[model samples]
Target: MTSAPGTYDAAAEAIAARLASGGAAARIAAASSLFARGDAIPHERRAVMDLACAYLRLHPGRDADGEPAFDADDESVRREILHQIRERFLASSGDRWDHQQIPLTLARTYLPDVDLSKVHIRSDRFLSGAWVAGDVELSHATIECGDAEHLATLDDDRPHFQLTGEEGDLHFEAERAAGSVSLFDQLRCHSIDGVGVTVRGGRVRVSGHIGAVRLPVLTATQGVSISGLVGCSFVGLLGSDLKGEVSIDLEPALSAVDISWSAVHGDVSIFGMALDHGAARVAIHLERLTVKALHLGGARVSTCDLAELEADQVTVRECDIDELRLDGALVDGGTIEYSRIGRLSVDDATLGPSWVRDDPPARVDWLGDESRETVIGLNIVGSTTEVPPQGLIDNDCVGTMGDLLLDGFPVPLRRDSGTARSGAK
Candidate 1:
């Protein structure tokens, strides 16, 4: 780790010295010896972590003579410190930390002594589950992620898995960074802000749940995904490659979800989701994407998508799609504009105004049981691609798109469609 502030305490320094002494085998023995002492009290253990974190915060990346700062030995010591925190403090196979015991407020308990004002935490241990009782900031800084050799020692359960999971109420905001991060297990956090952040590589499984999740101008390479999110505002997807089948089955409901200027490596399947009543604006949008399949069932999204969408009992309005292939899907007051589908097949599906949208459903007033959400209106018209000289709709088949789901709701959509179809109507 570069540009770190190192001030090691007795406990942290002792562990670092042990790790620096021997090779991987010797270090493994040292680690085994450390854990063999058994677990300490939650507060006591976190204090040890705080002491180590304090050291990291105070570490200076370079030396006075302009020589190699944090030499091989120093880097090894830093890596050992991170490994200690991960094995003893953060969650591995499971995060048995003090999340349940700590308060949600930052700095009260979670990483309690993190001296952000003094130094930043330059370790990969945070990728694992931790009950941070405070806000974490990697914003507007160059986040040089931990490297491979150091990351190799962190895999408690698997091989070469640097990140395993995260637990508790988390507030992570990242911007302008190099390197990568991976979410390898279930994460339960209330907030994750990744605005204008660029990650070289990342992986998000379908099991993570966070509230108020926001990502704008986020770019990642290859295997990048944010799948199966519970509820949050996904502002925009820029140069991100999402891969997975998503299912929204949570209570707080999904917020403004917008997807634009992105690529989907596989099918985007949405099923079983509802809107939270407390949400200010609510909607979903999909623009400028070249995806494979879109299967929607028991969901509610604002008119958005461009290819092969199948749905039932789902409420939508002014849907503009490309490559639309509907089989056993319903079409209420939605439009199929600018699609590449040569033939649109709708079988065993309803076609007309939504049976549920007679009354608008507010975020809190969604009309459905605990398990499913209800769709209201729908409209379809050929706009851009998937047409034979003439579009599926009339020449006046132009419409503007609305804001994303949840936050952008109360705001009306500014579309180019002469035939506007909104559930509010």
Candidate 2:
């Protein structure tokens, strides 16, 4: 291994001294041996380990003095040292080492007694097998592990993969980051706050309990996905153009939700959602929302509930609908399966052309059991037209005859010879 100028003798002497002792204690001491000494064995070496690990992690990059900072390029030495250390530590992986105040040398900066600071592991610096025990605060930092195949190599089941704070208040919030972070198994964080978080790439799956959950903001250029259960109440998704699926399982009730995008898909179970009108636009492919109320400021939806729903203009497309449905509330054109509907009601709604289809049974047959009592009422003014058994239809046909009015427009009409000769043909 390459050493920093004139520093070879001390390392060589240390290794030689351990070899001469030749025993289990000597082996243990040798595995963590360093060239410097300060009061005791393990206490002083903590600083050396921190510096060496940080230096090794940032190897290949030149130091401020233009010298090779670490010997990572030397595969033989790195492999030998790593193998020895792994063999020693892996045997008793759960063993905890109480490391006191230590200094970390990152690049050229020497951080003394680092605490509560965040570290970012970029794509190039991410080693294949990395381990940590202490709490790590990662809020909006990018930690990439590359593709799914390469990402699966992480051994999260190992007993040493713990990360907890000294005071028991650690948090991991990845809100609005551009890269990817793959936690193969369970990642336990005390609290997570993802408000308007933009996830541009990768998939996140957690099998553990989380303090809170929030919707991710997506763009046309990126995609995000999550499969987990969230326990928090406050969540926001603003200024994001979602194009992928966002699947979430919550505790049957939610407090707040904000959505603004058009490319949202999949299933979401929430108590309520506060939709944005200025920029919020989503074509709901499949959604199940049950809350006390819903407020939409500036937005459009493919389908939603009718009760406690208020918006400037909302859109409801073709999808299986249910209780408190807003089928005719706001939509340009879409199919409505009334058989699947339940407890539906509408006021000042714009009917979709696709909803007025001819059916052998009553078109209202599709309205679910809850809405069986709902009546479709209409009142039109300033028009003359024929009427049907259900309602009146305005029919004013003008041809070369100028004005020809039909007696029955919505109902069947019969041609009259007398009326034909009266310029009503």
Against the true structure, what is every candidate's RMSD?
16.8, 18.5
lDDT per residue for candidate 1 within 99-151, as digits (tens), equals 32221112111232121211222332233343222233322211223453534
Which portions of model 1 show Cα errors greater than 4 Å? 1-125, 134-190, 205-209, 222-252, 274-282, 302-425
| Best prediction by TM-score | 1
Instruction: Give the RMSD in angstroms, all C-alphas superposed, for model 1.
Output: 16.8
TM accuracy, model 2: 0.35
Candidate 2, residues 1-425, lDDT tens digits: the string is: 43432122354345534422344455345444542332234443433333234323323335688833333223333333333323222213343222112211122211111122122222211221222112223233333324433333321221111123322322211111113443312323333433333323444333333443343433322233333433434334444454544333323223334453333433233221222223222332222222222222222232444422222323222222233344223433333221222233333334333333222233343224523332221122212222212221212211111121223221221222222221121
Per-prediction tally of clashes: 50, 13
Q: What's the TM-score of each model vs. the native?
A: 0.38, 0.35
